[model samples]
Target: MTLNQMFDFTPVYIYIVAAVQLFIGFSLSFAIGQILPLRIREFMYYLFSFLFLFIPFLYEIATANVQSGMRSFLFYLALLITIFLFTKESFLKKLSLFFILIFFDGILEIVICSLYWKGICEKLFGLHYTPYINVPNQKVSTILIFFLPVALAEIAFNFLFPLLWKRYIRFIHLTTFVEMILLPVLCTNGFLIFLPELFGMTGWILLFFILFVLSLLFLHAVTQIPVI
Candidate 1:
């Protein structure tokens, strides 16, 4: 076994996945957004905000360690709760956002696995990859290159096609729910379930409020701008 594999890299790998969540979730910087106006058409507005503002700095402070994963994982739960609470977006936009979220949240996990295959594992971050955390087995080699780009494609789909398509929101959300639940299983140690733990007793409630506020901001902005 390699040094990292022998040492148990799962938790840190989880952290890397978490970092990607923050990145894709936020998709930050207002000025840069002008260049890619279509990005805001989907929930990618949030995704881009999270990614642009915090990821690189976060990458610098944290390790390709498990704590990093916890940061990513914990932060995203906060974000999801925010979304669930706020905004009057149609089910179709919500479903489209769900599709984009597939990669935005999962990429952290996928990237760590890719780095490992490339023999540069430690540089990747997240919950299961810390010195004390667990190492996920299985090399998702093919998934690495394609995953993010596909996420980008999903974003593009929502961006370019603002009108709702033939599919229904219920169907897509249910499918997304399956994928979300499945990720922790296929990933090691199943730590994502513990998200609210990091936030304390009222975490869910707080998340709801934040979502409410953000949704208002998004709606207000969308109504004012010519885009939506």
Candidate 2:
């Protein structure tokens, strides 16, 4: 097949792969959640929360499609706001935890992208690559290389954060939670979405640096919030 023809099918293939992954991930997580003890089941709820909220953005970032990435981020933001409004739980505390999850997810995205772009593809398959340009040459390998790390990272963070929160931060205050969610949304829109449109890859790198620093601040603030 000609290069253009091969590239043309990339999006369709990506969507199919992503759909399958999501189905399997959700099914397994739900099944496991069903069997766990009640306290541990709450942690499983945290896992479900990340899967529901962040997977769209995860797939978009893996594909390196900025337009779709923007849409996914906006979709995630909308879902978060909706959950905050409708849920019976303490909205502020839950929203704060969700944003913290987002910050870590963003950090993971940066790491995955860095590893992929810098040397992973070259070392693994001896091909210089971006998500789009050279995919047709190594389609399955490329997709698996990107997808596996992301999936594994999601599982790791989903498990780890709940434990950390239970141990270190049992609750967050209303004011701190407000700042936690608000600033990240503003910074994410600017760095991940808008600036990338204006400045291209430079803007993408800036997202990593700025969000990493912001995440540190987020962690610090969460730790400092007086535990109720």
Candidate 3:
């Protein structure tokens, strides 16, 4: 009828959207782990491990409902159990392993957020009203307080660990160097400042492309994985 009526501003809408996100994360991880090869999984785990570092802080912003929070936490915990049970990653690559663990936790959260954007989330769960809760997407204070630590930790974990994973250091160095160079520019351009926008997805697409290529090169230089 009118713009106001068309908007669907009901609390029921929030509940439904949040519920769908929780379902998609764990389900997709399972599907992916099942389909890909072992080596591919190793590469993906490394790639996704770094990608995941930003997720928890993002999710903490997205779903402010009480029911959403509790169930989502449990779902992530379960996703970890499933992946660990199926993984072939060695225990020794300590830095890589550390990233893998944290990334595993974060991916579940990211997948949930992605679903929220896709509009499928509302269909699975519906209409519940609750007290007012603020979920401003670009939560600058909260992001700085929680995610600043994560960003610093990424420096230590992603950039510094190469000293020990000496073989992969060159590639990790290259990877982190690129990230170091691009991160400030990205922040300035308003992804971090604005939040929830896919601003310049190309940069990230290229960045990850470079990281994966470098990883392949590094793996090739050190070990003789077939490149066919």
Best first by lDDT, ranked: 2, 1, 3
By the lDDT metric, which is better: model 2 or model 3? 2
Tens digit of lDDT per residue, candidate 3, span 127-189? 121222344233233323322333333333333333433455334433333323333323222
TM-scores of all candidate predictions against the true structure? 0.32, 0.51, 0.27
Q: What are the RMSD figures for all models against the true structure?
A: 12.8, 8.1, 16.3
lDDT of each: 0.41, 0.53, 0.38
Clashes of each: 43, 0, 1
* Residues 91-199 of candidate 1: C-alpha lDDT, one tens digit per residue: 5454335433443335544554455534443334322333323335423332233234434533443333323322343344343343343333323323343335557
lDDT, candidate 2, 1-228, per-residue tens: 753365564454455445534543343333223322233345546465445645554545466342344544544554464344434456555565555555655666567767865666678777664554235344565666656666666556555665655566546464566456655655653335654765799977976777787687677667766663
Q: Compared to the true structure, candidate 3 yields what TM-score?
A: 0.27
Task: Choose 1 or 3, whichever is better by TM-score.
Answer: 1
Model 2: lowest-lDDT 10 consecutive positions: 30-39
- List candidate 1 stretches off by more than 4 Å: 1-21, 27-69, 90-100, 103-228
User: How many clashes (backbone atoms < 3 Å, residues ≥3 apart in a chain or on different chains) does model 2 have?
Assistant: 0
Candidate 1 scores a C-alpha RMSD against the true structure in Å of 12.8
